[model samples]
Target: MSQVLIESLSATIVDLPTIRPHKLAMHTMQQQTLVIIRVRCSDGVEGIGEATTIGGLAYGNESPESIKTNLDAHFAPLLVGQDAANINAAMLRLDKVIKGNTFAKSGVESALLDAQGKRLGLPVSELLGGRVRDSLEVAWTLASGDTARDIAEAEQMLDIRRHRIFKLKIGANPVDHDLKHVIAIKKALGERASVRVDVNQYWDESQALRACQVLGDNGIDLIEQPISRINRAGQVRLNQRSPAPIMADESIESVEDAFSLAAEGAASIFALKIAKNGGPRAVLRTAQIAEAAGIALYGGTMLEGAIGTLASAHAFITLKQLTWATELFGPLLLTEEIVTEPLLYRDFALHVPRTPGLGLSLDEERLARFARH
Candidate 1:
């Protein structure tokens, strides 16, 4: 007998002050909240998961408030008595009743797997089918703003040996103006680093082609989401014209989107974020499809903290064909860490925790310190 039983679950909204404001092409500033979920099994084992959103949830269609509400009002009730080790059964019920709030669902999923890992005396990665690799390469982000500032930030990241690859944010609505800014940053970086640009669905096909020509001349690696996420026509046109390989972020929200993008050759590489594609299983399936088609897959981020980041790290290590670099460096930006087992970075790679389960422990005290109403 498992001798394990689920107990009451709790969620909190926490405000993590950024060590420094992180700007993107879309916007800037902070005040975002993370939806943190804690689950306990009567065997003295517990697990933690987080549901995070940027710009206070409006950007994603669900905020931490609604996340907590869904966890309390629906998900928790269905799991209070189920076996902690029966993860699949629990997921069946959770998915059957809750179709939306995929972010919230991801948080609860982490808690369930966490509980399972604790009960089985294993790490969450083991429950996910064991690890294929022990570490992942990391890519640093260049926040949108002045060309000088962006170039300076890139230089600093390189000097620290923290990031070997960089994703620079562009898109000020004018193609030539943004290209000029990118050119200046590239000029400063020289030939010592690799650079990629994320337009965040801000360019039209014609403008994207023009920008690609300018960036390609400077040895840029790839262009990400240059056109609207929903604009299939624009995607096709950009794919046909782009001199650099194209990658997709916002255009991919589900496995269906993944298949569609791959079929149309809209993306040469796919950015897989667990939160963006519904859950872990969805991400794996997408990666399998992508790799099958000879497209490289890169791990992505949703600006997640320790809990979500660990989940992503685990999935990334499991994916067999993760050739592209990952950007799971959200913790490095925060003023403090919420995990007990610190995630370490060395020589531009993130070390995967070898211990059983997700290989992370929540700092309950720190969680309280940053709780926001």
Candidate 2:
């Protein structure tokens, strides 16, 4: 048997329309752009993956254009001649040279894992290890920015049995105004749904100090990234003092950040994101750290499309426990899908497919239509 070498690597930028304008603290998302990654192997197998972000450079360092550019110029050259089956070696090679392109690396790593899984006739979950669960309970984000509208959306989702956990995007408006909005939605939904808030690092420590107390008292389930990621001491203080548990999102840019945050007791829950940690395997490293340190885990998303969502799902299914569940409702937020079949969401959970690789195939015509020329 001969070693199967990677023949080529390519990335395409696809712009997909969203169901609505997704309002975050930093920016409003009119649409989502995905950097679709494809890795061609000598054995004639091609694997697909996605690297997506929210609001261009608004969310993180890697924008869609930058991700595509780096994948083409830097990642492709290093991976083209490597052993396609040796994902560990391939990832290590990227790590040795790359500094902080976790978003780009995640897509490449997913493609490699997808390729390996396809070659071996196994699902990516089985390739990671064995899955403990075949489905994950997904949380929906209500970011319509209107209290009544957001409540209506939640009711519809609940009516359809699609979602019962709603996370509100706050911190964009005045603290009191945002508080009123969140509390109003919570009041309307009242015990029927688990309401949470992601401040998106908008609140300062002082504002969060009071806001966290109010949210916790009002029956909010969780508070995420209330203050800035740069204020380590403040995060530690808030974590220790807040009535509700604080979840680290932006603070964890890598696995090392997870370890450091754990050691410092900066947060009680960690938001596990594959793009932030480098890849599916790398994100698991962060999950292990959280598990070892007794910190809870919530599977987070960068609002990725189908390929990225399923890739994240495959990694998440292998976990022993996900204390805060997941927010893998990215696909549902999009008005269009580039995949042949959309992912199944039923009874408030996203079902993980047992099929090979990520259990998805690109709809080529759709992809071509959405791809940026």
Candidate 3:
């Protein structure tokens, strides 16, 4: 048998409309742009992945254009002649040269894993190491920015049995105002839903001190990235003071960050994101650090589409314990999909496919229509 070499790598920028204006702390997402990655092997197998961010560069360091550019110029050249089945070697090669393009690296790593899984006739979960669960409980983010509207949306999701965990996006408005909004929504939902808030590193430590107390007192389940990621000491202090457990989101830009955050006791829970940690295998390294450190885990998302969502899902399913559940509802937030069949979300959980690769196929016509020329 001959070694299957990577033939070509390509990336396409696709813009998809969202179900609504997803209001985050930094920016309002009117649409989501995905850098769809395709890696072709010498054996004629092509694997797909996605590198998506929120509100262009508002949420993360890399945007769709930058991701595509780097994938084309930097990543493709290095990966084109490498062994497609050797994900470890390929990823290490990228890390040795690339500095901090985790988003793009994640896409490339996912494509490689997808290709290997397809070639071996195994799911990405099994490729990672066998899955412990076939489905993950998905959390819904209520970012409508209206208390009543968010409550109504939660009720609708609950009514349909789609989601019972609701995470509110706060810190955009005044602390008191955001508190009132969260309290009102929590009051409306009461014990029927688990309410949480993601401050997105908007609030300072001073504001977070009081806000965290109020949220924890009012039945809020969690508080995510209350303070800035740069203020490591502040995060540590807030983690000790806050009544609700603090989850590190932006604080973790890489697996090393996860280890450092764990060592410093900055957060009790770690938000595991594939884009932030590099890729599926890389994110698992972070998960292992959290487990070793006795920190809980919550599967986070960058609001990716079907391909990215399933890729993340495949990695998440292999975990032994995901205490805080996952917010892998990115695909649901989008009004359109480029895949032939959308992912299945039922009974408040996203079901992982047992099929090979990411268990998804691109809709070429839809992809062409949505691709940004």
Among these predictions, the greatest lDDT belongs to 2
Q: Between 2 and 3, whose lDDT is larger?
A: 2
Per-residue lDDT of 1-373 in model 1, one digit per residue for the tens? 7568788788988887776666666667464467788888888888787888777643566777888888899888998988777777777887787776678777877787777776778877777787888888988888746777777778888898988688887775477887887777777787878888889887877777788877888788888888888888778777777788888888887788899888888878899987776666557778988988888988988778877888888888887867678998877767777778678888898887867667788787887788876
CA lDDT, every model vs. true structure: 0.79, 0.95, 0.94
Give every collision pair in model 1: 122-356, 122-357, 123-356, 123-357, 124-357, 124-358
RMSD per prediction, one decimal? Answer: 1.8, 0.5, 0.6
Residue 89 Cα positional deviation in candidate 3, in Å, after optimal superposition: 0.9
Any residue pairs clashing in model 2, and if so which? none
**Residue-level error in angstroms, candidate 1, position 369:** 1.4
Model 3 lDDT at residue 119: 93
What TM-score would you give candidate 3 relative to the actual structure? 0.99
The TM-scores, one per candidate, come to 0.94, 0.99, 0.99
What is the per-residue lDDT of model 3 for residues 298-373, given as tens digits with 9 covering 90 to 100? 9999999999999999999999999999999999999999999989999999999999999999999999999999
lDDT of 1 at 296: 90
Candidate 1 root-mean-square deviation in Å: 1.8
- Over 1-373, each residue of candidate 2 has an lDDT whose tens digit, in order, gives 7999999999999999999999999999898999999999999989988898888899899999999989989999999899999998999999999899999999999999999889989999999999999999999999998999999999999999999999999998999999999989999999899999999999999999999999999999999999999999999999999999999999999999999999999999999999999999999999999999999999999999999999999999999999999999999999999999999999999999998999999999999999999
Q: Candidate 2 has what TM-score?
A: 0.99
